[model samples]
Target: MENEEILKKSQKEISVEGTEDFPLVEVPESERKGFWSISVVLLGFTFFTATMWAGGNLGVSFKFWPDLILLITLGNFLLGAYVAVLGYIAYKTGLSTVLLGRYSFGDWGSKWPDFVLGFTQIGWYAWGTATIAILLTKLLNLPQGWNIPLMIVFGFAFSWTAYVGYRGLEWLSRFSVPLMTILIVWSMTIATKDAGGLAGILGIEPTKNMTIAGAITIIFGTFVSGGTQSTNWTRFSKTAFSAIFGSLIAFFIGNGLMIFAGAYGGLVYQEPDIVNVLVKQGLIFWGIVMLFLNIWTTQDNTIYNFSVAGCNFFRTEKRRYFTVGGAAIGTILAILGMYNWLIPWLVLLGTFIPPIGGVIMADFFYKHKMRYPKITKIKFQKFNWAGILGYVAGALIAKYSPGVPPLNGIIGAFVFYVIFDLLFKLFRINNDHVVEGEE
Candidate 1:
């Protein structure tokens, strides 16, 4: 009787402490989410102002009929397929990117991913906070001095949903996704009419030139980091189909929409900023509303990613606390001006981040054979040199290779991971590998 009572009390304490979201373990089947819920949240995460800006750049560089359309379609298809595979892995493992890192990157090697993924997410959070504030100040004609103050207000305010965890994200997405869709479609309609429909759109010449490879790089790099971390939510999927299909809807269709909208605005008014495009369309009121909702949805998700990565890095279950801490740190960066660093930041993410995903996929599919032992059942090395070396090889290729950088990084990491893993096994260097298990 006493033993039963002790077990009950222990379980009760765990339930209270880690209920925000399971930062260190699998989400129970009972807590899994359906397709619609996962779709909306993922959609909300993909919809962002920066992605449109990337599209706008592409718009000015490629013709609409074939080049722009083809690039967007092809690029997003690859992006969607990549994230969907990761989503499926997430579903099978019920783990976030960082937790999965343990099996692949090793116990301490996982911290490298923890730091890389965490920094990228926080950088994005800072950029978003600064961007909204600057845009708001400009649109409202507020004093220049108000920029820092507004950033401070928004930096913390945007994290409210994230602080509440997955349920908070889902609730916000359910309300905001529909409205955001309507606004984007409405603005696109205006842009099409202003440009004189398809015929006119086709007639507009690209003002600049970009190589196909470069264009694709921009398209893929735009969200590689977010897609890499999307498992933070996709792990909640109720079924493998829900995880894969929902990722496709969000990364392919949802992100594609943002890009197309920005490209349309650029083609029509020589503007890529959607809010600015709406303003020119005489919908300033709706423009403000769209800006707020667009940034808020993505901002919350970005910070949430940071918190998840942070939890894994520190090996804590206090995800909510990290959410707040991350927001505060992002606010400080925003005040210091992360907005101006967008282009270089994207380049860095494009080069360095994809390899992490590649190593993870290789680790899961090859080494573990798509089945990971329970966390408690396995002992991890301080570093998994195969995964680490594989990532290094991939990142180097991404930086120096001439073809599509993100794709190069992913394939390079995957192939090298297999090669290195084999070498390690051949030499008995990896004898202490993760414990064997069946799915």
Candidate 2:
């Protein structure tokens, strides 16, 4: 009896310690205010839009246009709306995406999504660093060997900025927003001036593949994944309205404007890099600013989110180490000429990212009813096969769909989740009801 009692007591102690070690994240309630400005959200949107538009412009003008830009744009808008709604929820709840997901995914299950999110962020950071290095090398007539040192330095700079935390990132937002805005406008003006007028470019139909849907798809694909990051940033909002309005304005207007500008430039210049085209058109200053803002804004958020995901995945101390380590690895990859090699990876991400959004949207709006359980209790055994099957189905559909725009990933995921969730509930298998924080 004594030995049994000692074993039981020791087990209890271990359980308590484990529980204490994994304390639930506490997020303070956001201050309710009507005076919040939309500028911050707008700035974020602008950053995303400019990046996508610039990317698409390069792809379309240099290579060939895909057939579904407008369709992809519509898809992007729908996804953006969905993201805005989630952002509103996050602003209202003051929880990050990972925290919010705990309600539906269970505490342990959340790790998978977190891992994927973190991995993607690291990839993006490397891509951004590599892109800037390549652009700089070409602009300055530097040798290819310089890419390695430049990538390492740039990665460290971005990681350090992220280490300073959200304030540093917000400062980046404040600076990049107006700076990029001016550069976009100036570049458009110069491009138009050089092209004679906007009338010719606007009226001239792009080649057969460069349809409106294709342009829109490129825009949407660039930002479709942004929804995953919305909660991280929306936590700073003063109100739900601010989050919604700000995100929409920033994404739609900011993104649309950049695409328009790029299309205009495409009509005028035959160069592959939009910046190079602008430089050749005597808009070198604006081109430089756009390149800088593009690199800074994109990499800053990528590093920040990667740090958050890393911290959540590993020990607190090790999280920082992993983040820096990941950044370093990515930088090395960039230097090794992996950036050029990673287009397929980025495309894969574009395909896979949408399903995640679908799962998240379904869980947030449908399963959780837009309100998280107050207690952290999650039903561990009742692993919703619905979500798993739905995700798989969505992926298959996206993969096998014939000639569908890349945005089909989101569409597939959304449809599969809805159908599977409805079917699961209808069948009423393994249904259990529990209060928050109850395991």
Candidate 3:
């Protein structure tokens, strides 16, 4: 059969017979979603507590006006641009980060990404679970002993939406995004007013010091892991415009807003957590409401990423089972106290995850010329040594020689992947029998 006919039949089989999320194969065009659906879900995913905590860390160190504002804008802009590129790739190929990994990292080599991406997501899930429980106990004046039980309950409960899949995420996002937006704006307004408006806000002084690079790392690193996996949802995009715009809106604007909210609260109330800020502002009821929505939206998305990666790693079609399993692992971590490890985790995420995106971008745009063949049509190597070497090179540079680690990692990975690929090609030409799989 011709490639075109084979492609058509494969797409039909995918649309008609497979799981809705298309964990193992491409997302057929018929399963593609619209801009509104994509935007809100991505936005909800960005509305997370850990991001706010990162912002709070910045808030304590930087001035409210030029310093904090500029850092937030620059960091988020870089993040948005990075994710948007991946989103475009996802839209074009109809594949998630892990599926894309199979092409770049090779069939077996892809498990590295599956493990890294999946582990980071579970870490986030654990943090969220612990945060809500700890905060609720403090804010509602509940017993301290309830933290573990609350963690256990919310951990499993948040995975419910993810277990149901995309529709569940989309439906919950539709309901929660608007309400969260309204609450955020309202809180911002109250914060500004309480601080005596613009003049008072600008007059606020930094109580601590942080370098520009450090601040940017906190901002970018906070979400870089999750941003790398955003292809899970962006692959469902019906148009390139939807994919790009939704990514920018979420990673840049949506995430920046959460950062600003935390920073703004820190500047005014000397508190970074928005829920804590709200409580201080005498919005206790609204604070609880916001806490539940904010954590739930991101927690569900985080677990969904883990499930997708889990499916790819184990070569299974049972995404729902992985979702539940991920939640349980996260719950256990929360019980063991993953909440206090946020900053170091953020640093690690910043230092490592961007290289994966860099390798992916290189694989898609440079190696494949922006087109990927049907997965079934090609046999992959056990490992794409070029990609593996590139990742290692990028990670080392990011960790040891960084002005801005994430940016450094990305550039390093891209350049190194191409160089190594060329070297491998030359080697293969000298000994064709040493090479296997499609070039």
Candidate 4:
């Protein structure tokens, strides 16, 4: 009992950081998390309502149920593979994406990823806050006039969780992840019953026809950006195996569940959001529970991502300021309905982010021979033109030359960054490598 109390107390100490900087310095092995703990948080992050929304859209978009299931499973596996690479690096190095970018994009050039990652997260924060508010109004049959205040209330409330940092995230996840999973399964069961049982659900047909590639893209696109950012959680993994398996399970199984829920709900009820479907079936209590927990999980993480990005960009310790500021902007945007308007823009922006991953992979794996220099004594470059160009080239390819834009961008950037960096080394053009830190 004494040992158990000590363990609980230790976790409580680490669980709520409460207005401190992200542990940007290298993490000691003792500080890392094992598979189950890290898996819960990572899985929690992907249990997003947006994914349900995407799945619902796919349900109508594809003509066959088997095809939708295949697409979602396959697409998420690809996503899992994409994030697993970074998760391994995070575990190996004990570094966040922002810190890792310092090695590839240079000290100052790395801020571009910080900005994109941070800025996009802020957009999502607002979208989520707005969505929850909107859904609440619908669920409770409240007056529409309450929407703005609701956004502010939820936005600020959720932002506080990010302010406390990953511990708070972990705490919330421990309680919410399991509960939310139960709610999801319960809701799906209820939905299945309402649709005239399993056979009836199986017989539901898609109202529209879309290409397999397009369908897969939507599934992949639902959380691709979040998948890239998952290193934030996976960085705490105790070992590379833990990181890989934890992240893979979250991405493939956790994410796949969300997609299936949305697609199933959308097909049977013609509503993409399962929250609405629940309400339609006179399960308002469950609707409200799922709605709040679902949106809260994603929104807090969105704010936390922005805070880390802000810290990287400004080199400041006042993460709370960024959290508040980002939440405020997100609230305003939600008030202005950026939720709907910003979606396509956000998806387009997601394609550009994977290049950063590609560049980082090349730099760490091949250029540095898979050993990151010690951060406290490292002499990494202030700017790496080759990496920057490769990232730009990848974005251009994604935008213009696309066969599946996101994959195109990632592959294009990976190949280009590798080749270009080699050229730079051969010709000594930019001399992008860091000087010896010890010297």
Candidate 5:
């Protein structure tokens, strides 16, 4: 089919599967999916260029095979556990991250999350697209002049799945994730063989010394923002078990492989991206396939993330406009080299983003005792000053306190929010305008 026809059909309308539009409403039990489906999409979400980017960095500091594995394993396990906790909460609440924020941050205050979450995903979308364009030019021997146009072309091309919304993302993830994983494993096998097998790969010494803490930070920092907002997809989980398994397997195994693939290629070929390493090893066709599928799986979800964020932010029924607008903006950013310039900034933002999760988690599990006010019943506040301040408290600690900034932010937010929330209740400082049970 022509790309234009495909794009047109993509935006035509949402079917039932694509109609999970009530961001604040509980997802009906009948609609939730089981383990495998959620896991596949989660795998797609975690497997992307950025994971490989981190892996490549780790390659320079591999230490030894066991130490490296332990580092990534322990690091991702912490992150995965954090995400799984949120996923389980999502399953219980049937609300997106933004919707959940309404409880903690008040109605107007939730926009902080809505905006930050949405903005980060938009950045990811642009970076993923730009990376694709750069790789394509290198693979095709295209001139530099084509980069901007290619970014535009690729941006629209990948966004169709996202334009169709949830069902589109699920369909694409199931089909593409396995293919991408296979190509990655194939590339790893080639790289290991080329590097004189596992012994040689293991024998390769670290060019720069890295601490365990540093390795752990890289693992978490790679996906903290995405993982924090995982409720966007996790709300579809049929059971807490599914959510847990999906997150754990995706983080511990799926993410492990992507990072390993990157580190392996980086150690062997002096390039962190496995696709580029494959190309260096003269596997151009596989490199191109890997690069395309890798970025495709990631970029669609990035757009989907923005779509959810946009819908939540604007409180709109039609999110396709946001989807298209996000794509256009992301593409424009790619054309202007947003990815290259934003790398360090993106990493820093990752630390700040997780504290938002911490506050919500604390509010849900502790203060509410796992029972949120029904969406229809509650007249949420305009501002929950404590929650907002708690997030700021977390961010400040993360920035200055040092030791694993993301963890510091999360813990700080969780502690401060809980403490302040209790004091508010003790002093009878709760919102006077709210009804107890207004549904």
Candidate 6:
């Protein structure tokens, strides 16, 4: 009885220490209203959503190789729904993804997810910035290698915006969102008119170039990385309804519009780049505006999320430094010609992101019964071997799966984590009872 009392006391002390070690990010309570708007904008700027729609539509129209529109659409829709559920949890808890992971991954174990999330964001930032630079160079008829200089400028610009923290990012969203919407609508209007009509494009022959699996892969691959950063924006939502509505509008609606517009443009001009297609169709100004808006909105969110993850990792208040630092690195990489390297990185990111979602969803919704510890009194425990092993196994299967569906990563990860977690509990591994209010 005496030993039990001592053990309980020790647990309490550790919990207190953990709470002090990692304090919740503080935003003024009065700023809550703005957070909702910010969340909407952040979600709106997701590049993957736009890219998926555009790429998928293009694949569907050209009769390139295989047929997979339905499969791809299904995968994208399902994944979006799953991500929205996770966003709802984040909104309710007001915790970043890293903190949320504590429940299942333990304290230290959560770092792995953080590392993956951070690296992926950096990769995305680099790719987006480089793409924009290339576009600018081509549009202006700049000299060869002009992209190097433009990339540097873009890096600084985005990093500085991120340095201002959430406020700067919110401001970016305010401008970029409206511009993107206008561009999308305008592009569609012009493209549809030029193509003879939307109906004509839709009635075109079913393309056999892109397979169902390939389309699914493109759709899923686009947003897989965004899953890790969902909480950064969602935590600001004032209520669950806001989160769901905002995510649906920003993800589904925005993506669908972009896809339809891009498809129409492709049919009208046979151009893969939507902007180039529009330019060829005599809408150069609108094309440039669209490209700029899309790149800006997406880059802003990427930089902001990357900064937050960096701050968490270093446990420092110098968020601006990391933001600028990362941007500089990204810019240099772009200039040095590293954007091509992102294709493989994107593949890796997609493969890993789904497992994280599965593990996190399982822990919050199923294992913990949807109870999150109070932010001010949270605690961290040792590494969770079950989660680690499960994640690894999922990644391995996703990486090595022989010509499986493109979404094999998500499927494999979700399955591995759920099954392994249950098996670990069945074997009585790390089955410590969590004391209510202790952490």
Better of 2 and 4 by TM-score: 4
Q: Candidate 4 vs candidate 6: which has greater TM-score?
A: 4
C-alpha lDDT values of all predictions: 0.88, 0.60, 0.89, 0.79, 0.79, 0.63
> Using lDDT as the measure, which candidate wins?
3
Measured on C-alpha atoms, candidate 4 has an lDDT of 0.79
Model 6, 251-328: lDDT tens per residue? 555554555455555555666465466556666666566677677777767766666667667655455666787787
TM-score of 6: 0.83
User: Which ranges of candidate 3 are over 4 A from the true structure?
Assistant: 1-20, 429-439
* Candidate number that wins on TM-score, 1 or 6: 1
Return the TM-score for each candidate structure. Answer: 0.96, 0.81, 0.94, 0.92, 0.92, 0.83
| Pick by TM-score: 5 or 6, better one | 5
The number of residue pairs in model 1 that clash at the backbone is 0
Off by over 4 Å in 2: 1-26, 30-42, 45-76, 203-215, 315-322, 341-346, 375-382, 402-408, 422-428, 431-439
- Summarize candidate 3's per-residue lDDT along 267-308 as a digit string, tens digits: 887776656777777877877787688889999999999999
Give me the overall lDDT of model 3. 0.89
lDDT of 3 at 195: 88
Ranking by lDDT: 3, 1, 5, 4, 6, 2
344-403, model 5: which lDDT tens digit per residue? 754576578989998998888877889886776778789887788889999998878867
Report residue 267 deviation for candidate 6 (angstroms): 3.9
Candidate 6, pairs of clashing residues:
63-207, 64-209, 65-208, 65-209, 66-208, 66-209, 66-210, 66-211, 67-212, 68-212
Cα shift from native, residue 61, model 4 (Å): 1.2
